[model samples]
Target: MKVHERLDQELSKQGKTQAALAEAVGVSSATVSQWRSGTKTPSATNLVKVAGFLGVQPSWLSYGELGGKTKTVDPKQRDAYRRECVWYHRPAPQDAGRELGNAAGFAFHGGLSTFGRETSQNILDEAQPGQPTVEARYTLIEISGSRLNSFLEAIKFDDLKPHLEAAADSRQKVAAVIRRGLSALADDGRLILLRVEDYGAKGLVGPEYDDGNYMAVVRNILDSFKGDNAGGSYGLGKSVMWACSQFGMVLINSTLSVAQDGKREGRYIGRLELPWHRLTAAEAGSPEAYAGPAWFGEKDEARGDVTRSYWGNEALALDTYLARDEDQPGTSFLIVGAYDPDERFQTIEDMHDELVRALAANFWPAMVERAGDDPGMMTALVRSERNGVTIKSDLVDPHSYTPAKARMLRMHRDDLTVDSLEQPGDVVRRRITLEVPKRLSDGAHGSQQHEAVLLVTEADEDDTDANRVAFLRGSHMVIREELVPGLRMGSRTFHAVVLAGLAAGGEPADKAADRFLRAAEPPEHDDWMVTPDVSSSYARGYGTALKNFRIEVRKAIREIVGRPTRDLSDGPDALKELLRINPPTVDTTKRPRVKSAVGKPDAEGRWSLDVRVSLPAREAPWRFSPVLRFGTDSGAAIPVVWEKLVPETRCTVTGDVVVAEAGAREVRFHGTSRADTHPVMASLATALVDVRVYKEASK
Candidate 1:
């Protein structure tokens, strides 16, 4: 390629216009255009300037020499380059008002667990094709003295300190958090940086401001370019990284699966999110009003003097503490001034444990190994360091952390599930249908029935989250978990998994179901319900479909693990008669009566009861208070206050009254007695419940 050809190619590849190059090189557009057209050759001085502007070697640009390789700028010249490579604060427009804080950062409450879950989901979403396992490692490092200063200098903390101080001076809600972070660094002279690295995944690729993962994550807000099966659709997951940083800053280093600018690794950039503020003319050389965010990179004069990512070398990566252990295709995020927003994790140990626990709890299925020789989708590790010394390194083992669920997933993958659980470790599989309504855009007549899988097995005695059904879809990350309702008393404690969409072995309707479920998820991606996306995209009855899907899942669980009916013949007749009260009698003239009641002692020693009431049909809603008392064998019944009452069906609970739906015959409500109000242990007492007509002075 000729000199003009190489120049033209670099210009096009870098998304730089001839006018931009001309302006940056202090030359006329006509001159640069002529040089591109091979009508003129640049002088040595302008050629070097042009090469520097385009990040190429002068010899490579002057001739087809050096294979047109990128210039590796020396670290000694960093200060000289720093003059051009500085933070670019976005100027606030005249018409718009100022922002107090970044709304996206507030999407999460800044818990370390939230950080782990969100970051891991992003890694799994970017899993490389044919890669057996995507690995995510979390490293927390505390540095002070010269080490801290060197790190801060690499990130140009001096340029950022002024902005942070200005934002904190405003005394806004976000400023309070900024103040605390500043105080910690100034008082303790130590700062903790959390570096999150992922391996075996597609890194942030594409142009700095175009439609790709890099732009979507770094430059935009609420713009997710993920596919239907991706765990995050809202694009708010990345904001949690900034939220975890007390200074609202995160630096990124990515090794791309696909090359950009003739390089595949050492892509470095930093983004700081702050509120609108103004810098004094004395400090900034000119009074400037900023709209909020700022970028740390070489100034791209081609794109309105905005900052774009720099292609650095190994030395630069090491200096920033973002050097990856291997040449893996993934991205690393370094959260500056890292601290748990909720303050639940104070020590490095607490943060490490929280990350491991969070990753296991939310992503155990993804970490579970398949049957036989196949590896799981992902693995994770959490470690802490102080001044280059490793304090703790924990490899999150899904089986060890969540044994029951992991076993259930393995059985599912191996097709080793049975029809019923007859003993310990027995896995039962059932098919539940999710009625996915046709999209409004489809113009179809009926809905697609997506078959979802439900796995249930007897939980280990030590499992704290037993007797709950965990719901997951394509990502294999738990979207939500709920205690199985309507299970019979003394039902075997078990763990259940509901696999929908692609997680259910990629059925014919998996794609459609995945799309529908993705639409149902909120920005948090924590639950599936009738969200705005679902309401606008799908036809009517989408909400009912989701509700039915949940109901069917619980019903299938009950059928597989519900306790069998007790045999009355096993007990003495007199004892049985005394123990069992007569069923509620039907009478048109009488008030409502309690038809059935079943009570069990919860882990907290509270008596939890499921009660059914029969009310005579009436035009007006029935108003009655449900009272709870402990039945004694030889004394008056002991009264206990109702701690919580939730209406299960055909009723609305207000205070102590159960208002049956108008014209409703039966009402089902669940209530728990206050443990503190109990005279004896809940296990030692029999629960008695009754319904009374509401009166003004009733108690």
Candidate 2:
């Protein structure tokens, strides 16, 4: 039957007047009359409304086909027939050899209702660490209205409103329902649909691997390591992009670097919507069915083979929606149905903030040119706003410490040097080395360790603080602030910012240290887990090298922070030397005032003296130890007694001297090591007595 006859028949069956049908469809009565008289056809929008008004499917009004339900025949069979009718009845394509029907075939057996805002977001969270790098401005535009109608010819399925939401288990449903509803959202001015534009030197060109079948390698290629020191273990970052879209659907449009014909023709368009149905081999392979993955770019019908598949951007659909005139070499991701408002990406500002923060945390070093796995530089630019509110890594982010900290470290690179641990290994395969630079600065020196830039500054592995060390590999700071068990120092917590590189100390890769450092790194590049398991020679070597590094760090710390010293000597000028050693640091302005000693040599040979010393109360914490410096003599032993007397054979007497509340103390000297020699007592007093005690150690 003619389309007008079908419309007339449906109106009569529903007992609806032409005027009532026109009113229901938001059309003029004259237009309805023209449609009924076969003078004109209704637009795709009005056709759907008129069909609904007459209690029929739009396919019935447009193509004289039955609705999805049937009594005598099976409902599944009838639904299948209706889908076929819709495809065949689609208006003839002005462009030859383009199969728009393939878009519908990719729908799975069960509807794609399993994917939603929350479900998709979960996938994104797990896959964030592996996102790809493209230096470009990524723009997401919210579009609707007649702009959606323009896709009717390329996308084939016209009335997508009903199928937008179907039963989760309903299989063999139309493919375009979700897309239609998202496009229809123009009526409400909501940003349900989004077109993502990734612009710059690198675009989203179609993959040239896996025999030009991107599906075979899209998910698998991510597993390969882009760099030895890169942070991610598995390359699943792109999965997050699909997860953010409703029904795991997105259109990829980009110009490839591959050349075809005489020119560098590389423009290509493709769709990455995993199939929903369990299709037959023929259906899965047919471009018309588009049952799994499909290419929708320029095709040369003359070729009449797989090579004829449009691998360039000559297709009108690709050109109109993707802005082919930009002439840039980046790709655009068209997320037909973007996720609804969520906690993380509720508004454009929210999205901008979240993405920028993530980038700074994981990729700041690369973004700011501090480090990168590739020789060619790559940076991230997210433009969620239409008015150009861009987030850059070079700017200081108050909430995040990575970007600003890394930038500061780059400025002080001269102060940093690669510390290494030497070990036994082949000259070319050595790996026991740490690349993080250790710097000693007055501002960063104190009783408490100061935080270092580009290093984990926390002691707790699970906690975020500026007191620990980060393990660096490739160009990434893989493990942040991992506490080394061997670095502990009694009750005093030891903190440091440590890192290792591919090589240290100018050692070749064959050296044991170099091999150990590289061998200890896990595939994930998160931590150094060198073990003593002999079965793995590399692991054992790594473990040994790591132990050496820990010991070196301990030694270095001790040298930086001096230890207490105790020495005694007896010479003619020993007293003078003792006085000099007593004061750790001599500041003329704050020297301790020493009064005179009141005693002379006694006949009994016991040296005794009453010494008076005055010190500021704040210096009370400084304890004084006295040493006796005797003249060079072979005569007899001299011992000094404060708490215990020393024998005469020892020329010098060193002991802790107790001071009374009156700032006076008594000292008796009878020269000898109490354990070895005879005692010779001498009583002496001299104004040159050194009364200065302990001085605080300074850096």
lDDT (Cα, tens digit) per residue for candidate 2, span 1-699 = 776999888778778898766445434466678889976655433454566567665544554421122224345533332333221111223443323223322322221121221112122222223333333333444433454444433443333222233211234322344444445454554443344443333332234433332332232334433333333333433444454555445555555443334233334344434333332344333322223333333333463322222334334324234434345444555555555323236454555455545445544443332221111123433444232222221221211344223422332232221221110000011122333211122222112111112221111111244233344433433344454444322211223433344312232321332233334554333445653321254322334445555555444533322222112233212234455655545333333332222222322333333333334334233344443322212422233333232322112234544332322232222211122122332312111234445554211
Each candidate's TM vs. the true structure? 0.70, 0.42
lDDT for 261 in candidate 1 is: 72
RMSD of each: 24.4, 30.1
Q: Residue by residue across 1-699, what tens digits does model 1's lDDT show? A: 766899999999999998767645544577688889887766443565578679886645753432112345477656544555578888888876898887888887569988988999999999988877787888898899998988888778887898898888886877888899999999999999999988889999888777999999899999888887798899999999988888889988999999987889888888989988777876666547778889988788898769898775555666677877668799999999898989888778788888889998999988776653234787676778887767776666665577567766776775555566543355788999999898886654357999999999775333478889999998988999989878775466689999999888676588789889988998778899999888988989998999999988988888887754222333432344466566334322335665545435655778766566777656667789887877544576688999878776788887788887778987878787889999888767666677777633222
Question: Which regions in candidate 1 have their CA more than 4 angstroms from the true location?
Answer: 1-84, 442-446, 564-699
Of candidate 1, the 10-residue stretch with the lowest lDDT total is 565-574
Residue 306's lDDT in candidate 2: 24
| Local distance difference test, each candidate | 0.78, 0.36
